[model samples]
Target: MLEVDGLTCRFGTKAAVDNASFSIEPGRFVGVIGRSGAGKSTLLRMINRLETPTSGRILFEGVDVTALQGRDLRRWRARSAMIFQQFNLVGRLDVLTNVLMGRLAGVPLWRSLIQHWPQNDKAVAISALEQFDMMPMAAQRADQLSGGQQQRVAIARAIVQQPDIILADEPIASLDPRNTRIVMDALLRINKHFGITVICNLHSLDLARTYCDRLIGMSAGRIVFDGAPAALTDSIARELYDLEAGEVMDDAPDFVPGELTPAFGNVAA
Candidate 1:
């Protein structure tokens, strides 16, 4: 389980996240919903310590990951895998090789640099690919695969890490309907099959309602509503999105408006 307690992140005078608190249990699939700049991504980043919080405690299985530094921090991050929106795979590397890289934290850096993945890592990577039915593309370069395939490969990498929690940030933002289903399907399977806690940052309520066991709504840097999908009323969405009655939309198809380019660049939190 993941416990985020009184989390706060400050950038200069403004707090990107303000005393945010939430807990997720194992095998639970939860969604974080908010308009851009609601501090959703910052909160996720803090989970793995990519961004440090100004004040707060984040306990991962009773260990305060927020207080760790150096080696301890690295270990905590490895325990919780992060899936980026851009599918942060090395395009030049083969899918299998990239997936095996997840074991690098445990392997000696010198050995990893020499591409000498241990036998166990190789078997683990292969098994992860088989789980995703991505074995056929294992030898292919990451750049050669489709967007959905790359995302699966990324998940396979996470699988090999044996993460207790998976943090996905707008994972389907760049995909079409079919690809979106493909990625979300894999995520749901991972959560159910492996009992890994999943906290996904989502743009579409449809996807959230379909896959999440619970949904968390955020606005102006705080979680305004946190509950089951059935409990998400229209008024909650309006308050979350700052929309008028008629203009309010629920579960619209995920879209990436070109103007929101560099999404959340000048995020006001």
Candidate 2:
């Protein structure tokens, strides 16, 4: 389990994430939803230790994640992989090499510098690519792939890391509708197949309801709602997004409750 107690992040006088607290069980798929500037990204960054918390404790199992430093911190990062909004792959590198980069923490600096990857690691990388139906593009440059394809490559990289949890920050924010479904399907497959805990930040309410087992809603910098997807009514969504009834009904079309249309096809598991 993961425990976050009074987690807070302040930017001078402004609180980016205010006294947020939550707990996640193993293998659960969680979605964090809120409007822009709701501090959702900051909260995830704190959990990943990419951004230091102003105060509070984050504990995984029995380990104090907040106190880890140096090698300990590096190990923690290796265990918890992060997928960003912009697919953070090396544009010039081939898809396979980019996936192999996940093993850099375990590889010696000299070997990595010389591009001398172990055969086992290479096999693992190829397996991940095949799982995502990205094996055909293994030799292609990351920059050449479509947005959805790049995101899948990014996911393949995360899988090769063999992480216990995957933290995705607005992963589908920039994709087209079809690509959005494809990306979310890939994430859903990873969670179920590997039993890896997934904590994703999403802007789409329908996607969150369709994919996540639980939802955490934030407003300003505070967590205002936490419950199963069905429990989040339109009223609660309005409150989370600070939308008036008229705005919710007319202005914010995406806020209305609806089913997420199924993807054209599932990526290979």
Candidate 3:
């Protein structure tokens, strides 16, 4: 459903993403794993056109996404929704209203400016919230929700967009273990039940293996490994993170990097 060819993004003397190329099939749940500065975020932003590539061809459904302009680009972005790590919602706005913002891409500017969504649009947004069991909080201000609740709200907004694909950039990086599971489960359900293609950037190897059907590992802005979660070897994972086997284990109470034994073993506590 999506293909990236020889994608490159440079900033002055540095290249954030260097000739990265990959493709994702429809309804596939894929995970991008890498250490910091591995260009995972830059790669997703480029697909969303938030970051223009220095050189590359991004094709979606056989069309050249990189060549689009203005309304076309806007329309393309609407088809590929983005879920940011920070839960980028209007803090003061009510939860339902924030989700309705997803419709702004298709709605008239006057209606959006006035926050006057038609009943159908409101129903769509509400139904999205209901999917995540967030309807009870619809009247609450976005800022009043907890981190996990806010992330669910963000997912609701993405769902209301009726996107073909969801690009999640480190969606659970800032959450507690409990909240992390909630957000991950939500994404997994969306991909499995709704069949929406989901490409998530994940720091937790265990989480990636648990939720994603395929895993793509990056090193220094390039894809180093692409395969099923069970096929990811310890050596390859260490190489992707530029870490040695001895340094891969985490001693934190909530995480046991040591437990990551055997193929597709639990990567975190």
lDDT of 2: 0.86
Sort the candidates on lDDT, descending order.
2, 3, 1
Q: State the lDDT of candidate 2 residue by residue for 144-203, as single tens digits.
A: 999999998998999998999899999998898767777787888888878999999988
Runs in model 2 deviating more than 4 A are: 244-269
lDDT, candidate 3, equals 0.86
Candidate 2: residue pairs that collide: none
lDDT of 3 by residue, 139-243 (tens): 999999999899999999999999999999999888987677677777877887788999999877767777789999888888988999999977677777766
User: What's the CA error at residue 28 for candidate 2, in Å?
Assistant: 0.6
19: Cα error in model 2, Å: 0.5
What are the models' TM-scores? Answer: 0.90, 0.91, 0.91
Please give the range of 10 consecutive residues that has the lowest summed lDDT in model 1: 258-267
Worst 10 residues of 2 by lDDT: 251-260
Q: Which 10 consecutive positions of candidate 3 have the poorest summed lDDT?
A: 260-269
Q: What lDDT score is found at residue 224 in candidate 2? A: 93
Candidate 3, superposed: residue stretches over 4 Å from native: 244-269
Question: What's each prediction's clash count?
Answer: 0, 0, 0
